[model samples]
Target: MAALQTRALSKSYGSRLAVDRLDLEVERAELFGFLGPNGAGKTTTIRMALGLIAPTNGSVEILGLDVRRHRSEVLPRVGALVESPALYGYLSGRDNLRVIGSQLGRVSEKRIDEVLEIVGLKGRDRDRVRTYSMGMKQRLGLGIALLNNPELLILDEPANGLDPAGIVEMRDLLRNLAAEGKTVFISSHVLSEVQQICTRVAIINHGRLVRLAPVAELLQDGGEFEVKVDQPDELVAALKRQQWGGEARSEDGLVITAAPDGRGRSLIKFLVDNGFTPDAVSARHRDLEEIFLTLTEDPVK
Candidate 1:
């Protein structure tokens, strides 16, 4: 069963559609990335997924149970850290967890300790939340979500306010969670981090999905290759002659063009066959940020 799924899920505030038939499925144990620009209805979708707000149309399923119909049973199996965790500043970190734990029912002292350690707030759990840094507070919030040891985690901007080290730690922690067979769905503007951690990604713009693909597949920009050749200009001229290589160009002392049959070996053979020995040949990769901008900038139909 899919850990989380949305079938034509949509939400609107009167005439304005915030989310439009957004369909997505995150398989069990998958590390999934949900990406969008500001005002793209990501939060609205999340709210509906958590059953905080009902969808205007369609439905959401968590672990194969309809969220609207089985909210009680579905919510317990899911842990979420939304836009910002509501935390009492005056309370110590451990006390904060203790308080939320009470509402979660039967959370043990050992489990609390484990959550603190997992979120990297072990020794500092005694510190007041008011005195903690933004990153520390974020960790504490994540700790609260983890108190129940949920099977699915849905997080929004989890690395918000985190320092470089904190970001790396969070990345490692999330990877470890997925490795241990937990499903993690993350919504964030941090494209670089998402590229590294998420296996599959879904991008939405104008409340509609524009792309859904594996990170590797999304980064592969039409099988183009970057070749460091001695005669870049000559190579470009020769490549542009072929029907498959009409888009060939010389950029930054490199011959940039699509490979013959989208294979590196074929491109290498072509180069050698055409008397243009390449110093190096590598498949060109587009940055996730670049791809994100390209997809979201154009309004989805």
Candidate 2:
């Protein structure tokens, strides 16, 4: 069964539609990425899924239970840290966990320690949250989310305020959580981070889903091959015979993406057979930033 599923889920505020006919499915133990620019309905969709707001149309299911009707049963199994970390300034890190723990019913100190260690806050658990750095506070928020050992975790921009080192730590932690069979749904504007950490991704733009696919496939579509040859014109001409030829260009002894398959060796061999000796060949996959720009830059009609 899918860990989470939504069918034509939509939300509208007055005349403006925040989310429109959004359909998505997250499999068990999968790290799913929800990506979009600001005001693209990513947050709105998440809010609806968490029952923080009602959808004007469609429905949501968590663990195969209807979100609206079975929230009591579903919510307990889900952990979420949306937008900012919610922490009491005066409460110590461990005390904050204690407070949340009380609501969840007598959580043991050992479990709190386990979560603190998982988020790399074991040593600072006794410090007041106000004294913590942004990254530390983020980890503490994550610890609170993990306090219940939830099956599904929804993190929105969990790396928003972190420096490079903190981002790396957060990435590793998410991977560890998924390895333990927990389903993670992460929403972020940082495309590179999502690409590195998620197995599959869904892109939303202007309140609509633009694309959803495996990370590899998405990169493959936008991949480019670099072919360095003695005769650029001949290689360019040869590539022009293929379907993707029109998309290829020649630049400074290098032929870029001018062939059906963006493979360098075949182009070099083609050149060698045709009386040209190519120096080097390489394949370059599109980075997450490029792919994201291509998908989101075009306006949603």
Candidate 3:
């Protein structure tokens, strides 16, 4: 069963729709990224999935159990830290964990230590939360959420206040969680970090899902198809005549783009069939930031 699944999930406030027919799913042990710009309905969708808010038009399920019907049973297996984590400024990090763990029943002192170590806060476990750095508090919030040893972790902007080193630590921690068979679902606008940490990503823009693909596939950005043909000008004219958008450089030959749909090879075959000998063909890959911009900048269907 998918760790989490949303079918036609949607939310609206009066005339404004926050989410629109969102169909998404995450597999077990997958470090999944939910990406979107600010105000793109990421948090709204997460709230609906976690049963913190009701969807206007659809359903959400966790491990095949309906979130609405099995809230008690499903939520226990899920842990979440949304936006900025709330911490008790006065309480020691260790004591804070004890306070939260107390609600779930007799949380052993040993369990608190284990979580502190997991979050790399063991050295400062006794320090007041307010005295800790932004990175440390973020880790502590994550530790609090881990008190239950949840199977599915849903975090929104987990790296919000983290510095470079902290971000790296968060990334490694998430990878380690997934390694331990925990499904990690996160929402963020951080494209590069998402690319580095997540295996698969779903991009939503203006409350609509524009793309969903593996990190490697998304980064490939349709593969830059560059070739040096014997007749550069003729090649340019032929490509234009065929309605293929490509540019011809004076000294460098022709530069074209190929999506995963095999358009590049078709172009090559068309050139060969027309008796135009080509010197060579090569492909270049794009990074995640570039791809993210292209998706969000275009019109969504």
Candidate with top lDDT is: 1
Candidate 3, 11-90: lDDT as tens digits: 99999999999999899999999998888899999888889999999899998899999998898788888888899999
Candidate 3 stretches with Cα past 4 Å from truth are 221-223, 226-256, 259-281, 298-301
Q: What shift in Å separates residue 45 of candidate 2 from its native position after superposition?
A: 1.1
- Give per-residue lDDT, candidate 2, residue 266: 62
Alpha carbon lDDT of each predicted model: 0.93, 0.87, 0.85
TM-score of 2: 0.91
Q: List the residue pairs that clash in candidate 2.
A: none
Worst 10 residues of 3 by lDDT: 243-252
Candidate 1 per-residue C-alpha lDDT over 1-301 given as tens digits, one digit per residue, 9 for 90 to 100: 9999999999989999999999999999999999999999899999999999999999999999999999989898888999987799999999999998898788999999999999999999998999998899999989988889999999999999999999999999999999999999999999999999999999998899899999999999678999998888888999999989999998889889998888999999998898988889998999999999988985444
Give one digit per residue, the lDDT tens place, for model 2 in 227-298. 777778877777777776677778766788643454656656666777767677676677777888888896
For every model shown, what is its TM-score relative to the native structure? 0.95, 0.91, 0.85
| Model 1 pairs in collision | none
Worst ten-residue run, lDDT, model 1? 292-301
Error of 3 at 128 (Å): 1.7
